[model samples]
Target: MTRTPETPLPSLKERRRLREAQSLSQADVAAAVGVTRATVRSWENGRTTPRGTTRDAYARLLTGAEEVTPHQENPAPALVGAATGPVQTSPDRAEPTPEPPSETSPASELAPTLEPALGPEPEPGPDAELEPLSPSLTPDQAFDALYAFCAPALVRQTYLLTGRRELARESVERAFQLAWHRWPEVAMDRDPAGWVRATAYEFALSPWHRLRPRHRNPEPPPAAPADRALLDVLLQLPPVYRRTLLLYDGVGLNLPETAAETEASTPAAANRLLHAREAVATRLPELAEPKELHRRLAEVASAERLRPAKPTTVRWGGEQRARHWTRAAIAFTVVLIGATTLTLRTAPDHYEPPLAPGATVHGVPPRVAPGPLSAEELALRAKLKGEIASGPERLVPEAG
Candidate 1:
């Protein structure tokens, strides 16, 4: 009387539990195998038999078993039937059970079935209207999306730097405009909105633009606004000090990046940053109250939210581009003309008629003899000629 071990069968509930343990829903598994959830549910409930490829997929997914066609009958006895046979344990008398083929491994079957669903999803059309106020961004979208994304932080930063709502808004808008011109390139950059904010900060600090004749008035200076008094003091500091303060305190750039951006050594940038901090601390006591400063910042940021988006009708199309080229061409022509004219005016003139022969010496022409010299003149000429002939001989020592 030998005992035979029972072959255990997995229950439907157990199969479902296994699927759940693998982090797959019935619908997900169905989708993977191009079947309906209802079909998957029926399989899991054991309500219907899965056939053909579906059966093969199920066997592979659930138990790592090869798909056996309905026509192909197994010669070996079923495990359930084998359990009824008498147990025998002698090595030479042992019956060999055929193992399932390795091609039907669970991982291999499931992996192939699951990969198609995880590939890159197609993007929505360009003209598709975005969800209202959501950041549903596209590659070719306008710069307005970027502006909306960083508006809050930019407003806060601008207020912190300028302490004036109007100036802050202007500065931020100008920076955004500059970025918009290069939007195609900038939008692809990581943290593009942050780059714009940094550009805005630099723009606001530029002395040529910020303190230019266009920004100034001929009238007498008015009393400094209380909220912006500290900002005024900060502006009065040297440009290097201002940049160091803004980079360190306002934007939180580290010393090395700041030094690289400002073209200063790390130690020099650090010193400038330290001096700026000290200057701000020293000036804070004489400027606006802390509460007032905070209130101004909040007010400016609130105002920025209320500011309406500009009309997008302004076009920089081919016509304008052509016009720019035309202007450049005209400018180049003018420069060429001016350069040629200046060269002609400054160049020396070397043309002169050859001098006439027998030109007057000092305003008197040479006296022409009216006739041949008289005898007296001839004798004088002869005596002068004789002196000229004997002069060299007389100069030589006589016989010595």
Candidate 2:
């Protein structure tokens, strides 16, 4: 829609530029717009669009800031260095580079570069809330619009995948939380909804949820027999086939797009979709027709009141979660550092040989004193003196 004289919303890029020009955090604009910071971030990202009062407020904010930031464009280059280099390399490059150390968020950071499985992304649901038709939307508006548009349908989609209400809701929220975390990468994504969709699908179908106690037992199935049967069939299908069928038949994504979201080769996706449809048809022959199956999928999903949290709630939860993890990480790091320091201080610096235990010695002679001289000692001496003359003969006789 063309911007009217009354509400002149800026282009997506311009909204971000203006916010940056004004040296504002998303929180600042969010407060001014009466929306959450995440909504403002969404607007800057073009995932949603501001509408009605929010749109007008956003327009005025941008319009007014236009006057305030006129000087930024002129001085930004000199002060922060030219955008030609820094914007390309350092400034944005420095945006957590969440990829390098953890290489985690970059699945999205790197996601933009990765092509969807070999096909055009299927047209997303009516871009009504998505505002694909509204070019003048700010990123914040775009994000809010995208969330409001995609979130409900996505929740229903997740329910179909998981057959559980809470898990479905949690999965969708987690996906959006992730989307918000990597808003920059997601905002720049060719299909922000697809990005969030893939993330939600991956999370909903995650094998780990089974381990949680709450999800250990399956939720009660739909009350209607038909709904229950359809859900049972859907749940019975392999997660891959279930996702493929739901994406292609249920969500109305094209073959390639379904394959892309499922992260399978186009042929593999087709195979899964075929198998899924076959299984459903086998279970409920009435659902043999693709349209019928799609209808049933939506009907069964909607049968349950699988309400997702508000976008604002998801956004706040994401921020709180990120903060929680960050604090945990800092605490862990401090503990680790303290432990290392303690080890260094208390560790022995040099080796010292241990002393051996003392033992007794053996095979030694005992000291003895001679008794008093015998009485014969004087007689022997007198006799020997008298016998001195006979000593030679006595010695010779002794030898004989």
Scored against the true structure, residue 259 in model 1 reaches a CA lDDT of 57
C-alpha positional error of residue 389 in candidate 1 after TM-score superposition, expressed in Å = 68
Tens-digit lDDT track of model 2 for 1-400: 9975546578888987877667665556656766544346556756456666667778878766423222111100001111011222222111111113232321111111111121123233321123233567765666676787677778777888888888888888999899888877887665788889899988888788778888888788788999888888888989988887776666655443455567665456656766776788788889766555655666676677656678788888999999999999999999999999999999999999775667555786886877666779978878778864754676765532
Q: What C-alpha lDDT values do all the predictions have?
A: 0.50, 0.65
Clashing pairs in 1: none
TM-score of every candidate relative to the true structure: 0.40, 0.57
Leading candidate by lDDT: 2
Against the correct fold, how does model 2 do in TM-score? Answer: 0.57
Candidate 1: where are CA atoms >4 Å away?
Answer: 1-142, 151-174, 210-212, 218-226, 285-400
lDDT at position 317, candidate 2:
93
Q: How big is the positional error of residue 46 in model 1, measured in Å on the Cα after superposition?
A: 66
Q: How close is candidate 1 to the true structure, as a TM-score?
A: 0.40
